[model samples]
Target: MFKAFVKIAVLLSLTASMAFGYQAIRLNVSEGTYKERNDAFNGILEVDLEDAGFTPKDIHPKIEYYYKLFYGTKLLKDGKPNPQFKTDYVGNLDNLGFITISNEEWMRELLMKEPKLGSFAPLNYLIYKKKSEDKTYVGTLTPQAMLDIAEIKDAGVRAAFTEKIDALSDATDEGMGGEVEYVEIDKLPAKTLIEWEIPFDRGEDVLDAKFDFMEKFEKAFEAEEYIIAGKRDFAEYWVDNDLENDKYDAYWVYSLCHFTFSYTVFNVWEHPELGASAPCSMYMYLDKDSSTLKVGMPSVDNWAVFGKITDPKRLQFIKDMDSKIKEIMTSLGAKEI
Candidate 1:
C-alpha cells in the first residue's frame, strides 16, 4: 500500500509540474535507442530546434565516452590497475551529451535589455538515455525558472522568453515522443546564478585584447583542472549566417566541467538523467563600445534541485563548485555585480 501511495505521489508531482510549467528540469522520455528513434533526440537536433530558431553552436556530441577517461584517471591515480577497476564499465548511459544552443535573433533583440539572459542564451539542450530504463530523456531547464534565477523583472521579456522555450519544447515533442517528466522540486534554491564582470582595455584592436583575455581565462581555469569542453562565438555566428547582430562587438559562450566532480555525481551515484544539466554554461559578452566583459552562469546549486539531490555531502560539493567558480572569476580581476 505504501509503495502504491508513493507511485501516486510521484505521478501527482509530475502532473503538477506539467500544469505549472516550471519544475526544476523539463524532460521527455521516449522508449528506444538513438537509431530506433531515427536519430531523434532530442532529434540529434540539427533540424527541429534549429529550424525553430534554437540554433546549436557548440556540441559535446558524445559524453558517455567518459568511461575511457575514467579508466585513465584510475590507472594514473592508483599507479596500477586493480581488478575491481572495470576499464570497460561505461555505467548505465547508452547516449549522453551537452549541446549548447541559442536563438540568435531573439537574443539579439533581448540581450541589450537583459544581458543576464545570456546565462541561458546558449543553454544546455541536453540529451541522454539510460540503458537500465530503455528510455531517452531530452530537455533543458525551464525558462520561467531561468527568469526567476536570473532575477529578470521585465514581464515582457519573461513572456517572450518562455514562449521561445515553449516553441523549443514543441520541437522536441515532434522529434521525440513519450510522457513528460520533472524533478519533484517546486521552488528554486536560495541562490540561482553566479555573475561577474572584469574591465579590460579594447586597445588599438578590439579583437587583440579580447583574444588575450580569453587565452588567459582558459589557462586560469585549466590550472584549476576544469575542462573547457566547448565554446561558441555568437558574434561570428551572426556575421557568417548574415544575421543582424551589431549590438555586441564580441560575445562568447563556454562550457565548463570539472571531470572528477561530474564523474562523482553522475557516474558514481548513477543519476545519468542529470546529464541534462551537465557542463555549465559561462557566457562572456562585451557590448558595442563597452570595455567590460560580463560573465554569468546558473549556479551549481540549481543542479541539486534538478536531481532532487539529498545527500548532505553531495549538496555541499555542489555548493562549493559555485564558490570555486566565483573565486576563479575574482582571481582574474572580476568583480561580482
Candidate 2:
C-alpha cells in the first residue's frame, strides 16, 4: 500500500508541474544581422490575450499601444539592445516603457511558479509585452519636443523687447538730465499673439495723424491701374515694367496704410538692386483690415538702425537714396499719396 501511494503522489506532482509550466509564446522576431547595411529587418509573433490570462476590459482602452523587445547576439550601434531584434507586443498588450524585472529574476519566478514548463534559458531576449490596455495617449518627450516647449516658455522676442525698453529709459534720463514722466499702455489694436505696445507720448495725436494719412492714401491708389490678387484684407498687386535697364520685370506686392507697413510681402526678383526703392507710381493706404497700426509714439522709425541695420555704409546709402527719391517725387508733383 505504501509503495502504491508513493507512485500516485509522484504522478500527481508531475501533472501539476506540467499544467502550471505551460506558457504560450507571445511574440518572436529576428532583427539585424547585416553588417554592411545599417538598416535592420523585423519579424513578429503573438499569442492570444485570453491565453495570457488577460481580460477584454484590460485590452480595450490601450489598443494603439506598442512595445518593442530586443534579443539575439547582435547589438545596437549604441551598444544597447541588438538593433536587429525588434519585436512587437502580442495579445493586445501596450508597451509601458521597460519592465522592472531583471532577466534572472524573471526566469526564476517563471520556473518556480510553473515548474512543469521546461527551462526558459534558451529565451534570451528583450520582452515588451503589454500589461494592460486602458492607457492614455499622452505624447512622448523627445529632445526636440522638450526644446520647443522650453522656447515657448522663454518667449525670447518679448524678453528682448523688454530689455530694449529699459535701455531707452536709461538713455532718456541721461540725455534730458531729468527722469521723464511716463505711462505704459499694456494693450493695443491689431496685435499678434507675440506683439504688444506701449505708447510713450501724444498717443491720440499720433494715431489720428496716421489714420488720416492712411485714409487719403487708400483713396489715391484706388485706380484700376494695378492687377489685384488675394483678398481685400490681404492682397498683392503686380505691375509690368517697360524699362529695359530695370532689373525687375514686374513689380508685385501689396501695400497697406499708405506704404507705412506691408503685411504681405511683394516679390520682385528681377532687380535685386531696386529691392529697397521707394514706391514708384505705387502707393498704399491703411484700410479697416490694417486697423492694427493704431497711433503709438511712431514706433521709433530708427528702430532698424538701432536694432538691426548693422552696416553704416549701407545705412547712409539708404538715407541718401531716400533723399534723392524725395527730390524726384517733388519734381514729378508726386506728393505723399
Q: For model 1, name the residue pairs that clash.
A: none
lDDT of 2 at 67: 15
lDDT of each: 0.76, 0.24
Across residues 1-337, which tens digit of lDDT does each residue of candidate 2 receive?
Answer: 5434433543564465355532111111112222211111011112221222211111111111311222223456577766535343123332211111012222222322322111111111112222232211111111111122112233443353224323322322222221121111122212111111211232355345444544443444443122121111111111122222112111111221111111111111111111111122121222222332211111111212222344676455435434443443344334432
Query: Residue by residue across 15-131, what tens digits does model 1's lDDT show?
Result: 776667457677767787567763776454757877767777777766666654554345645577643355545566667777878777777767767777777777788777766
Ten contiguous residues minimizing lDDT sum, candidate 1: 1-10
lDDT of 1: 0.76
TM-score of each: 0.83, 0.16
- What RMSD does each model have against the real structure? 5.7, 33.1
Q: How far is candidate 2 from the true structure (C-alpha RMSD, Å)?
A: 33.1
Highest-scoring model, lDDT: 1
